[model samples]
Target: MEAHGPHADDDLVTMLTRTGERVPHPDFDRYAEDLDAATLRRMWHDMTVVRGFDNEATSLQRQGELGLWVQSLGQEAAQIGSGHALNGNDFVFPSYREHGVALTRGVDLPEILRIFRGLQHGAWDPEAHRFHLYTLVIGAHSLHATGYAMAMDRDGLVGTGDPARDGAVVCYFGDGATSQGDVNEAMVFAAVHDAPVVFFVQNNQFAISEPVTRQSRVPLAQRGAGFGIPAVRVDGNDVVACYAVTRWALERARSGGGPVLIEAFTYRMGAHTTSDDPTRYRTRADESYWAERDPIARLDAYLSSLGELGDDAREAVAAEVKELGRRTRETVRSWEVPAVASMFEHVYAEPHATVDAERAWFERYERSFAEQGVHA
Candidate 1:
């Protein structure tokens, strides 16, 4: 099926295609220069496998193994593309549904599940992967990223004229977050201070049942203009475009070009979370429309053109992903829940009047459970 729909644009920054065709483009192609056959293949394989992991996570939620699962089903390219554009020292502040980005940053899949399973606040170290824990507080992490970027400038970690030492910040949020005061304020701070941060908005169309149309009068990309941040809108499903656009923005930020905004026009193929019923709000027709524009299918077709993705290669990837799914399921089952008192342990890490009282009260409650023979 060819492109169909009312709003489809022919000039969309599409390089790879659903057919085995790689179109030539000055901007989109140059950024993909280092994407040798192996790297392109890896991108394809990573998208496929991370999508597999996303599916398993959703299944586990359905089966009650996880308390909630935020599906990255239709938005894989947006996450992985921008994610791969980051430098090693670049810090990432992600919204809740960035599983693909987490995979790119080498975060353990089980640790990701731990957050959704309600087993831990955030199970991994941010410093290890340079990827912060999921921030479900809507677009609030944008402020965190901005503050971190400012701190980097003060610490002389950025704008030292050394690509090897300079660090930048990438903050992820959704179109829904644009309606937030916190997000707008962060933009203000970023532009005013010229913070080395990129505000990456994954405009996945719906902010839970409300469509993007209801949220903004103009394209979300224009929002950055008010704050003086150069903004660009990219076809988020096209991982190549996403990577290129984000790489440009990140490099600009890293080079002390200040903050940039990238509006990734993608769709959330699944519910807001397992708790959401997208069927109540969105139509099947809309889903079908985007299904034809599936990111994985497009890249796979491009890879096939190069004869890089043979049947054997696909089979091997499928087997590896199957094992990954199996491992994730088992890990979810075998994982231990944290102790109740342990919550208070992290509340302060030091003695505080109010916290101490809360801890003492919590301990008393636990002792009461023991006295009542409530041992598990």
Candidate 2:
């Protein structure tokens, strides 16, 4: 598949160029006009920190400290920008690779690694953070998010005119997930019910080894329009555009507008996961093309031009990034194996004869290891 860089399309909503130049948008520029140098600097810090965290996770996976890792490497701007636009009460349902979104939601970085380290089913409280546990099943959470949005609407959360009480839902999934039946069904239900939801599709150009071209002949943004929902495509590498577009979509959803779809045109820039090999299916030339539009670098350049990110600010951010990597490494290494019996504890609300018997057998099997002077 031929690579389509951000500059190739004029229709893409954008506020920043590949070379980090700030540009104006007729419709969307007003949304970002309120963003001063301070806000932009904060955004730069966020994107830089998350990218550092993502890189640390990748390294951990390679070092065998983590069983697996999914990177948000090149797509940091799409996540961090949209994440910053969310209201505190708004809920987010994310796929497994949404580490940047997790960071923005105040989820403890180490807690996110617990699942990948095989220590727990889920480590954080979804209610506390308003960020649901990462869904590993492809496209399943789209239905979950839609159902939640319907519930929110029924509970008088929609069109309330009260910003504090009104809220919307954000459902994030990858380009590959667009092909799933569940995603289509979710969109259908969301549109029919006029649910207050924003379907955030990060179109990272590839679904693992399969190119998006093989999946659809038309732009993915049209899928939302087909369901009678408003849709917009943004240059996913442009942080300002992402923030503006997401804010617009969320406002519509919160104030009685139905479901909206945002197709973030971006690239993955790495393997789909630690288990996949991009080198097998994609060429290095394609990787290099996206690298020029690297979101963090682009934002850095823009911030530098405005004199918002100088040597001092860069040094501070670097220190923070270094500390984050150190903390993550320490935390992952210090994790102790949870008791084996803990798994059986949450299998059911009430004790069952079958579960009891299985637990008893497992305990006996575990004791067998102790008898043989081996760790179970």
C-alpha local distance difference test of each model: 0.86, 0.91
Error of 2 at 180 (Å): 0.2
Best by lDDT: 2
Model 2 Cα displacement at 8 (Å)? Answer: 7.0
Instruction: List residue ranges in candidate 2 displaced over 4 A.
Output: 1-8, 348-357, 364-376
Tens digit of per-residue lDDT, candidate 1, span 126-161: 999999989999988999999999999888988788
1-376 per-residue lDDT for model 2 (tens digits) = 4434322345789899999999898988878877899988888999999889989999999999999998999999999999999998799999998888898899988788999999887889999999999999999999999999999999999999999899999999998999999999999999999999999999998888898887787778878888999999999999999999999999999999999999999999878999998999888888888899999999999888887788999899899999999999999999999888888886787888999999999999999999999974
lDDT of 1 at 7: 29
Q: Alpha carbon lDDT of residue 322, candidate 2?
A: 98
- Model 1 TM-score on a 0 to 1 scale: 0.95
Q: Which regions of candidate 1 fall more than 4 Å away from where they truly are? A: 1-11, 349-353, 372-376
